[model samples]
Target: MDVNLQFWSTEGKSFFQRFLHWADILDPTVLLNSNKKIEKSRLLLQTNAQTLQEPLQDKKVKEAWKLSLSSVHPGTGEIIPLVFRPPAFLPLATPLLFASLLPHRGAKQAIIWQAFPYFVMTQHKLSGPMQTFFKRILPIPLLACLSVFNVMIVRGTEYENGIEVMDKNGKVIGVSQKAGLKAVQETALSRAALFGTAVIIPESLLYFLYRTNFLLRNPHALTPLRLVMTVSALGAMLPVSFSVFPQLGEIKRDDLEKEILSSTEETELFYNRGV
Candidate 1:
């Protein structure tokens, strides 16, 4: 049976959803940072628990508040460098207490709120390297294999069942239904010559784009997009290779599983730790 593959639409999703999805992935750190900051503030509150000293003026508080959390966080494997400074909010009223004030720059609010509950309520637990590498990298490679497909030319006059042919008028040409019983050798080659020839350009272009974004902002978006492109390249190439020699398409999940399972414990604990 012939199966058709579809891909993620170029059509975009709402910005908030994308932002939140990234937040979902990144929330552990954000939450950790936020809660740590709140705790710092609360301690400051408890110690200097006096009423606000003449409404909070832009007058600089202590140089800056810094907290360095040294434990490994989950999911992304990152160390949380939790830092907090008093919010730079435009104070409307005189500062009675620092706790009474709010930050002027509220852009971090959603990030803070999303992470706060998680920080307060939960402990992050994530997979070790063997599990992680397989869970993360395996799907990406598989995904890449699925995303791009290719057609190929075969040497023999008798066509294979899965092969597709096109005529000059954009009509699909069918191979002869007749099959010979004698075993025949097949030599398969790529249908899209240009794709095979210039694969490096696309791969390099994606890398350049990713690096440029990394240099500029290094935001969450750049990382995933880079992953998408990287996987896209792999995906694009795998099928093309398969089309050229269909036997190359065969991937043994059993072998892959064994390899991943074997290395479960010796993997670096910190590599599995989130930064």
Candidate 2:
């Protein structure tokens, strides 16, 4: 089996095992590795996979797996763009988060909404749904919506290209659009959940922290503190969201569309759920 395929196969692990697996892959340091190193890691895994289940364990092999998996697309075997890669997400979002956290912007929103009643039965100042959306917990869901939209725009071609289904022997059997859409949908939801948690938790934590005397006593700590929280949330959630759905999704032969069904006699097959 392809190492990537093996990683996501049903035999791989339970949720906790998958969580630990992704935690290694999602390490941001993978972004620092050179092209040469990534190829070497791929080679190591390939050479050792048949002989060793753990694959010649050592720091080099381990780090190599991390860099290769995180940097390269499992489906296409291409280097994912820096910004779009999971490890790079925190680095890209952290600074903008800090800027958004400036007191003036939040103060403006709080001031405008402060006077509005929590529950306005009159429905004149603002409609009930509108008020709840803007003032309540819906901001996270809205961000999730945008996450789905972005995924569609950025990687829509994967849906069109269809997934290459493979037999247990690792031979390509056929392409299936059903498998492809499932992968994309799961990825979209995972991304939404990831960013939603990342954004909401830090702000909520800092909102309370802002009132504490510690921040007042040392305003300089705010920058590092914000960085810590954002990175921590991503560290915790990336594994979860990635593991929420299997990266290699399965389709029973009976469930596939008529066109895809005729290509293989096997009762079950697998497709790469691109990261």
Candidate 3:
């Protein structure tokens, strides 16, 4: 009994030590310090600073460092710490934090649209594998449609008064309803493409993982691994998806209504192609 107690105590100490090591590695402060060091070194080289303190004294360098340490509003130039920036930090920390916790009607609709079809499909008497296959395939198109719908709803309403028709000198001319609608449509198509890729690629990889019984082999780690895979797939595709569409939507003067073209100074018009 004494020998057994000693063995258990030794194992407990080992487990505690491993946990501490991992905790240190995962700590945000550790990551922050490492980032700060690398950035400071870069700044020093760029500015030809004799010391770190010299670089920090520059007003622009100070602002840039602050921006690097946190999130900033591109339009307003408002700087907020990572913890304060709900959009960036919340999604990284909690997968469904904004979906469930926030008062976003669009997010709620997206969840329902993605979920309701699966619930209905499950009611029918289908084989387990068949049900799984249908569950994966059906949501892809639904999500794509939802993405388009969301884009139209958000951008359509925002530009309901018509987008500002700018001249070559960036002066605001008369608004153009047709131009606004065209911009919204372009954004909607782009969103549909992004959603389709994000859903299809991850689901395809997940299907293969299941077929190989990867989850079964590591049953305890299944949920975490699946979450990691989904997040990673979306993260990898997000930049590529965004780059697929130009943010500055363009339209020819001929495409606009006769009145709008005659009123505007420029031969061509541009509007914001929202994400």
Candidate 4:
């Protein structure tokens, strides 16, 4: 069974189970695995006679799965980009906080920086609109749109190549573009939700925290406090955001296009919804 498909599978599983696995997948250590190691793990599973119904009692199989899943791409069979991998997302993004939050050195940079947080308000700020009103909002609708556009540009071929769809027994059926689009859409939504919750919540919380008695008295504490809030928010929201949709999404035979439906009589087909 492809690990991503297994994760996306909703059959008899609850949200909590998926969330826990997602947490493991997002662990930073997985980013350290080499291509050789991932191939070894995949080969181990392939040689197992019972791979069709895996998660065997052998603890090695389970560990191998985590490594393979974290490093290898489900549809493409290629190593995920170092910075873009799920586990590396937080680690890589953390350093960016300094640049994002701290004051910039030049006028042009300051203009762009100020526009990002309360972008809607920045344009109107010149017209004397209230800062309080604008500070409370983010351009999330625009962010989500851009996020989707990015996936379309970066991995447009995946939709045409199609994501693998499977049956209940972990057997491969066929690939379909319809299923691929759903997976890509869900993944994009999750990415947006992740950033939105991570950014908006911490900023909101810290905005109030800065006014509190303790923070007001110790101004130096706010910098570390904001970093901690960002990490906490990102770590906590990563799994929850991805779990918004099943990793393995279902498309009914009736709903599928004739290309796939004509081959399989199975009413429920599963596709690996991209992470």
Candidate 5:
């Protein structure tokens, strides 16, 4: 039994290493940096060959390094910077904007409505189990509502100007009157459903695991283990959520305005249904 356990552990480690290597290949930043490294190496080799007879001076070597760093690849003709900024806050921007647009009473009511669930969950008087239960369940509904609101705000903004209609060749023909609103409604419903599914599945699994004492078995490792479990759950759910709906939304040409249909020969059209 001990030998079997050791073999399984070794296999698990190998599996994780392979998974990380595959993830690295799929990572955009890593791929970009790798290409940059290859380009820099080639440039250094060419520079070294040219200066082989008379070794480069210290200043010239420094200059060459700087030039290699700054030089863009001939293929892409663009230099990727070393620093990267993640757009983590982009998802929150829409919700904040939606809240800002409401009247004073409406905004106050919205804030209170959203905050009430959190307040109840965090109340000091509540028992630990009750608090944990609320914490797990409340986020599902709250997130679903917020997702719907975000979709409304986005679609409302697009409705003001209308969405661009394109021809079969991908050329913009004209704007459709209510096509944007319809697309937004469909996307919003789909997203809300997906959000609920994604949140509920993980929360349910975690709740069960917690009840079984699977997560609390190792007191010293609890925090890191929970974090890893959470990340793994999200990673597993993302692909399933994305697969739930078709990203390219289809609309009948007849649903569009007369002018738009006349401009395009196709009876059906497709547009990116925003996530």
Candidate 6:
């Protein structure tokens, strides 16, 4: 990020030193100061102009200084260019833009469909008092499933407290429970648990609020109120899944060690159960 130059010359040491001093002020991108004759002659003019108030000698010294500053070395012309941009800009951006268009739409619809079945099944074949009662209570079971998904279990060695998350540089970024379970099962359950909980919790509250006429109604056309509440509730969950947890993060350092110690003792008792 920072650049500097080193000047070398064969003139009398004092004169060459003065030229190097002047060259230091120019802030050249490359090093080039091998001409001792030019150095001494320019140094003399520069020294003379510093003491004089006349414009003509000042102009002459300025020209000499410009010539000295402009010279470039053919041998040491290694220009280290400024690299200010990231290398992966295009590759990263293209996928993200395309993802926003096609894949994201399908993924979002599938997520909604998966969650819809839980909601619809819970509300199945019930009406009036029964429908209202199940709506109020079904979200609790969904929450229990979610609590299990959020629950982190550790079951490995050389992994801290059964958790191991590392970066590309072999540095531990954090602890992870993902490795403890089969990858496919963990991912599928994690998604199902989260989506189920997300849809249930807010929908239950909104359903009651809608039935009781607690939410404000749009004036002119008179919307179905429940439809409006459902849409709003669904919109609210997006921020919870994407923004809320990500922004409010937790970092646990000694946590893994404790979990590992506990899991070790717990596992020993299990294997010794029959014996």
Which candidate comes out best when scored by lDDT? 2
TM-scores for all candidates?
0.19, 0.77, 0.60, 0.81, 0.52, 0.27
Q: Comparing 2 and 3 by lDDT, which wins?
A: 2
Q: Give the Cα-based TM-score of candidate 2 against the true structure.
A: 0.77
Model 1 weakest 10-residue run by lDDT? 2-11
1-275 in candidate 3: lDDT tens per residue?
11111112222234343233222222344224344553553343345433233424676554443333233322233444445442253245336522321122332354654456545654675667777654556767876787788778877764576775554444555677887888778767766776577556656776688889986787776566556655665555444444454444557877777778777657776554434
Q: Rate the local accuracy (lDDT) of all candidates.
A: 0.27, 0.70, 0.51, 0.70, 0.49, 0.34
Q: Which pairs clash in model 3?
A: none
**Residue 245 displacement in candidate 1 (angstroms):** 7.6
Clashes of each: 15, 0, 0, 2, 0, 2
Q: Tens-digit lDDT track for model 2 on 1-275?
A: 45767656643447776787787777777788777877787877778754235632577666766776677777667777778887886678666544543333233343222223333422455766776454544555665677788887777876787778888777888777777777788889888998788768887787688767778888899878887887788667778888887777777888777887788799988888766
Listed per candidate, the RMSD to the true structure in angstroms reads 28.9, 5.3, 16.8, 3.5, 15.4, 23.3
Ranking by TM-score: 4, 2, 3, 5, 6, 1
Put down candidate 4 lDDT per residue, 21-78, tens digits, no spaces.
7788789988887878888888886677564365645788877778766777776667
Off by over 4 Å in 1: 1-126, 144-217, 220-275
lDDT of 3 at 24: 26
Which residue pairs show collisions in model 4? 8-247, 8-248
Candidate 2 local distance difference test against the native: 0.70
Determine the backbone clash count of candidate 1: 15
Instruction: Pick the winner on TM-score between candidates 2 and 6.
Output: 2
In model 6, which residue pairs have backbone atoms overlapping below 3 Å? 161-256, 161-260
The residue-by-residue lDDT of candidate 6 on 145-221, one tens digit each, is: 54344332322231233334332222334344433233323433443443455446545665566676666463332
lDDT of 5 at 129: 74
> lDDT (0-100) at residue 171 of candidate 3?
50
Q: Which residue runs of candidate 3 sit more than 4 Å off their true CA positions? A: 1-94, 97-110, 128-130
lDDT of 1 by residue, 89-108 (tens): 11211121112112223334
